[model samples]
Target: MPAYEIDGYDNLIAGMVQPIVTQSIIINQATDAKFERGTVLARTGFTEEGMWVCTIVNSEATPAEEKVPVGVLADEEVDATTAQQRATAYVSGEFNRDALIFGGTDTIATHEAALNAAKIYTKRVVK
Candidate 1:
């Protein structure tokens, strides 16, 4: 067997890192309103807490927001020196554990257990 690197990356340890993708939207803050980073969001039907990141809205969500989990506000404020962040508007990309209903747990559960845990994920991660 042989170990190797590709594209200047240490291939042997590639699995150690998982880069989750995210996006941001202007929540249209008022005089005192502001949103913070790592805020979970959805298209429609928000609750008092959880399942939502921002407290403000630009307008009533059109057709239940972007039709899927629009990711979170990767950048809560402007960056004077550089871009706050970068991401795609719409696409299935990796997200931090906070994006998931159940925070990232590494337990190797059985099929049924994993399915049970992933149920809410399936419903919220997207439409």
Candidate 2:
């Protein structure tokens, strides 16, 4: 008998996202090696030249800016272990509440208002 490998897909988006607005951002390598889809992101407030670098939203982050939820990562997986990787993020969209990823002790309630301010809405999906 041969061993088999199985992979499952996780649907992150739950509602319509007309226009499909997206933003190209750099995922800071220091933040985390890999991030799954629907991972909440926050701008580190640092820009090299012009490209913006972002990290997972952390409630305990200092300076306040980094604590703000900016958007949700749109990539299935982004590996930035070696160096910062450029990835697409949904700046405005409706996402599945249960599918979102957060850093530290943060939860959906911790970022609901911030996300809404950024035009990112979250809703529960029964499936």
Query: What TM-score does model 2 achieve against the real structure?
Result: 0.84
lDDT of all predictions: 0.30, 0.80
Question: Which digits, one per residue and each the tens of the lDDT, describe model 1 over residues 1-127?
Answer: 0112135632112122333333333332334333344333333433344333232222233553422344433443322223222221211233333233211232112112332232212222321
Off by over 4 Å in 1: 1-24, 43-68, 76-91, 99-127
Q: Pairing residues by index, what is the TM-score of model 1?
A: 0.29
How big is the positional error of residue 60 in model 2, measured in Å on the Cα after superposition? Answer: 0.9
Best prediction by lDDT = 2
> What does candidate 2's lDDT look like per residue over 1-127, in tens digits?
1112225644677778534478888887763558877789988755667766888898998767779988888877788978878888888988888899998899999999888888888889888
lDDT of 1 at 94: 37
Predicted structure with the largest TM-score when compared to the true one: 2
Per-residue error for 11 in candidate 1, Å, reads 23
